[model samples]
Target: MPHHLIRKLEHFTKLSCDDRQVLGAVASKRRTFAEHSDIIEEGNDPSHVNLILEGWACRYKQLDDGRRQIISFFVPGDLCDTHIYILREMDHSIAALTPVKVAEISRASLDRLMDEHSRVTKALWWDSLVGVAIQREWTVNLGQRTAIERLGHLFCELFLRLRGVGLTEGDSCALPLTQMELADALGLSNVHINRTLQELRRAGLIVLKGGCLTIPDLAALQKASLFNPNYLHLDREGRNLDANEPASD
Candidate 1:
């Protein structure tokens, strides 16, 4: 089976056969969750870290009044959080947005892997930093960008990310998010999300239909969103690690 984690890590640094084998073993324990189910709830101690193998999930914080703010979306190849075992309890919850499959890696296994493979450990660290960077960018998106701009930026980010993991087909990718979900993620009301989608459609910048998002012109969409791919750090930050390993076939 194809491993999205390996594909994602290879974006930053080449992985050796040993590294791949270890990762495959780590990911062997798989579980499935139905849509809208809580994978990990707030205030609970988690013994294992989740590696998303399929479908989408989100980190969200809910208020006393039942309002929810989505913090981040996890696609295939995303780790829910690294070193999360250090926390006494989760501050927020992670839930499945769609039918999800995950590999539950125990803390002990991860510790052994880190101890044995320095390069793999560093690559995981890089992945964690990229998650932080995306969080920062989302803060800016929510606090500064207009509703349309925010949507455009999000679309651009998703396109690039799915592309990185080989999920995108040319200019299109599966969105699988409802307008209500988009509203929650972007901090907009359902009506506002619908109107923004209408605007984007009218401008011919995007074509979203049947759970698929297609950017007719990526450059124009990026310009509209004022998106800078710099925050993503997709440029092989862990490339130096490649020097230590033999060339991969």
Candidate 2:
């Protein structure tokens, strides 16, 4: 079932029983990929929207020198390329960060959902807008924030985002990326990312071990990073709708 997706969309609006059922149907069929495998490559025609059902994936651009810049991380419940069908080809590639399972939502299926389900359509719009907002914040992260601040901000954002989708456990969440991958995402050297991680650990703001990240004090970390959640637009804008499902992680 696409419980995670339902949980995520309900954060925006109340979903009816029918809405949940249809969404589940769309995500019922899934495909799995091994770690490091490419789910979608640059220049591929955008036919289906991939929904992460398990594990992690990233959308990235590769330079001629073979260096990569990870643009965004996709977790369960995330809809990859919701509006990218309008594009003739994908501008970047999406690869699995871990063994991943995704639901390939065909354009025809998506069109039917949007045409019939008003609430789902609205929530999808919110999802797309939030994606752009996150990209903008990432730009600021790479351009202005110091190394330590960048790492902290990214941690806080991921924790909150995972929590919103019911993937977090208390103050900790799964963080499967390696230090090198973190370096690529933040536009820093591997050594810089290592040093920054050490700094965060020393400050008692984070605990990273065994592929898990524990933020003992999220508020303090957010303060140190100057992180703000406004760009996420997670304030439950469609609170008026009737949501029948549970959203607790």
Q: Model 2: how far is 225 from its true place, Å? A: 0.3
Q: Which stretches of candidate 2 lie over 4 Å from their true place?
A: 238-249
Tell me how far the alpha carbon of residue 246 in candidate 1 is from the true structure, in angstroms, after superposition.
Answer: 2.2
By summed lDDT, the worst window of 10 consecutive residues in model 2 runs over 240-249
TM-score of 1: 0.95
TM-score of each candidate?
Answer: 0.95, 0.95
lDDT against the true structure, per candidate, is: 0.91, 0.91
Q: Count of backbone clashes for each model?
A: 0, 0
What does candidate 2's lDDT look like per residue over 121-214, in tens digits? 9889989999999999999999999999999999999999999988999999999999999999999999999999999999999999999999
